[model samples]
Target: MHFTRPRDLVVAGLVALAFVYVAFKFAYGSMPRLPTLAGATLIVLAVIEALLAFSIRARIRQRRVTSALAVVRAVALAKASSMLGALMLGAWLGVLAALLPRVGDLAAATGDVRSALVGTPSAIVLIAAGLWLEYCCRTPEGGDRKHDDHPTG
Candidate 1:
């Protein structure tokens, strides 16, 4: 789960590459509306995912939490991030499904479906990378804890 790990870095790199590729494809109209929508949703999700990953990294670097309360705060933040991610993903897919068929051009429709299928794996990769980053940030090391000291005392 460590962000510094080679596997994690590879995954992150792959996800980033896929994001760029999909973005470019969508922009040039190589991707249809449905896939484009999915890609767009994935892009947004990726951003959130990256932020969560960064937060995890920060938490780990800060290592300022040994108590149950700190654990609770971390868990709560992780849960909220997860919930938001899941909801957004669901909504994105739902919206895409609802709108895709209504648009004309069967070929374009098929293209969108294909893009979604291809892009989904990449999206999953991105999510996993983000989660991994979060895991990395939650360290057991006590050295990083500084906020535990009350400044006013």
Candidate 2:
């Protein structure tokens, strides 16, 4: 499978943002506040993944421990999670954009916008962590001759 691209994730997020914003603009429905607890949970997940990435990389390089299958699985999971985070961030940004203008006019819009602001950064942190994980999963130099050790940006 191809590696995850930053452009792809940005496009996905932009699309979601537009779709969500349009829906909110038309007042078809409103999204609930993003939970602070969910943000905390995501932060924890990012920390764990970041630590795992470093640990796995060290193990594979030192030859003290190695598991190609495990690394592959981790890479897959990282890609998926990063993409998901990007998608959610775009949606949250869109929601905030849509709500900011209406916050003063509408009583509840303020709270919704506030939550979106909070959640957007949290999602960004998750994306960064996932990308780091993907980077760590790359094979060390000499492991792959067809391509260098550097990962696809």
User: Highest TM-score among the candidates is held by which one?
Assistant: 2
RMSD in Å for candidate 2, one decimal? Answer: 3.6
Give me the displacement of residue 151 in model 2, in angstroms.
13
lDDT of 1: 0.49
What TM-score would each prediction reach against the true structure?
A: 0.39, 0.84
Writing each residue's lDDT as its tens digit, candidate 2 over 1-153 gives: 556778989998999899888978887244555454455466777888899889987887787555678989999989987998888888888888888998889877876777777778888988998998987776677444344435556
Model 2 is weakest, by summed lDDT over 10 consecutive residues, at 142-151
Q: How many clashing pairs does model 2 include?
A: 0
- Against the reference, the lDDT scores of all candidates come to 0.49, 0.79
Please provide the root mean square deviation of candidate 1 (C-alpha atoms, Å).
12.2
